[model samples]
Target: MSSDKKVRQATATVTELILETFRLNGRLIEAGDELVRPLELTSARWQVLGAMDRSAVPLPVASIARNMGLSRQAVQRLAKELEKGGLVRFAKNPHHERARLVTMTEKGRAAFAAAMAKQAPWAEALAEGLSPDLLSEALAVLRALRVKLEGHDG
Candidate 1:
């Protein structure tokens, strides 16, 4: 093959990694859906809850979406749904009048705790044979890629 028509080896490897990441994302979502189903939450909803749960303070939909690498509109919709379900409530944001903060209700906290309880054993099983160092390296690589991509999203 001509050099002009050939892909760089590193580029090809990155492309493969991207494809695998896509597949992994789908499978993870499916597994998350199954894991949280009995709690009346889908993967997306659980993810939103997780974002809120991880934050030290309540966040607006836009912040939650940004934190989760999701679209603000999608997070806004989910926030509304969660509000209606009594899982979360919108509180007045002192910083922004229009962007109300999303706070998890008691029910939301309970559901999130339950979901995490389920995840602990599942994650342990999946990591049974994996080295912690390997996992840390993988996480670092993914974070670096994410930072690079985010920088290019202007």
Candidate 2:
């Protein structure tokens, strides 16, 4: 096969992979919405809480935004809701004068844990019958591609 044809095939495969991935992710997010509704947390807010909860130390708002690939303003808004819910605390950052630290409260941790537990069965169901080795390879490739593409306008 010509190199040009191979390149075109690879591009088409990548595009389809991305589109299908997004479609799958959209449904997952919708599921998250339903799961978190009782806790009065949006799916996005839950994501933030989960991130903070898993972090070893408090993350500054800017760092949270960067880690989540969201804008600072978006993180700030979510911080407000998390604060109102008593799911997160905003503390003064020792290093950054203007940036406040964001961390999940104990309640937030428990809530996130529960939410994850609820989702795990679904994830397992979806991932069932897939080869672990193949899945690992695909994940590694996607992770590399994501890092490479990060911050670059597509």
Candidate 3:
């Protein structure tokens, strides 16, 4: 095949992958929202809490956003809402004067635990028929794509 045609074919495949990723992301968020709704947590809130829970130390909103690949403003807004719901609290950051550390409350911990408990079986079922090797390959491809996108200015 001509090099130009090969390039077009590759670009078309990448575009399809991007679109499918977007659809999958939306569906995953919707499923997550349903899974945690009984616990009074939306997917976005759960994500922020999960980030905090996974961190070795409490992080500022900016740090959480960076870890999660989200916008700082979006994370800050979610943090404020989580704080208002009594799920998390903002404490003084010994390093940054204005950027307070986000800590999960007891309530937050319970909610996170419950959400994770729910996730275990759900994830298992989702993976039931999938080959582990294929799953690993998919994960690797997605991570590589993410790294490429992160490095791109456009």
Candidate 4:
């Protein structure tokens, strides 16, 4: 292809990627909302629970925010609700003088386990025709692109 044609194709690809990201984000939000409804949690709150479940050790609210790609204040608020629900508990972080660590409570673990059990079949069906290789490549490419977009030394 000519240089001009290549440039146009690249631009179009980027544009499509951006638009599809927005579209998929909406779907994900909706799916999350629906997924957590029976658990009586919002999508954000559910995500906080999931973050706590994934942490090797109790993580500070800031750390969870960074991991979950959410604002600290937002996660903190959701954490507060989760705390009230007896799903997560706060402990003092050894590394941070002022930050409290958040960890999943047994209730939180049960909730996550139950939710995943219900969701597994749906997820499997969604991926029924997808190849593992393609998924891995997509993840790698997206991660690299995100790093480059962030002005990181990717």
User: Which candidate gets the maximum TM-score versus the true structure?
Assistant: 3
Candidate no. 4 TM-score = 0.88
Ranking by TM-score: 3, 1, 2, 4
| Backbone collision tally, model 3 | 0
Tens digits of per-residue lDDT for model 4, 1-154: 9999999999899889889989988997799789878988776777888887788888999999988878999999998888999998899777888899988889988988877776788688878999999988888877877878768853
Q: Which structure is stronger by TM-score: 1 or 4?
A: 1
The sequence of per-residue lDDT tens digits that candidate 2 reaches over residues 49-106 is: 8778767889987888888878989999999888888888888999998888987888
Q: How many backbone clashes are present in model 2?
A: 0
| Candidate 4 displacement at residue 52 in angstroms | 1.8
Please report, as a residue range, the 10-residue window in candidate 2 with the lowest summed lDDT: 145-154
Give the local distance difference test score of model 2.
0.85
Poorest lDDT segment (10 consecutive residues) of candidate 1? 1-10
Best by lDDT: 3
lDDT of 1 by residue, 19-129 (tens): 999999999999999999999999999999999999999999999999999999999999999999999999999999999999999999999999999999989998999
User: Which residue pairs show backbone clashes in model 1?
Assistant: none
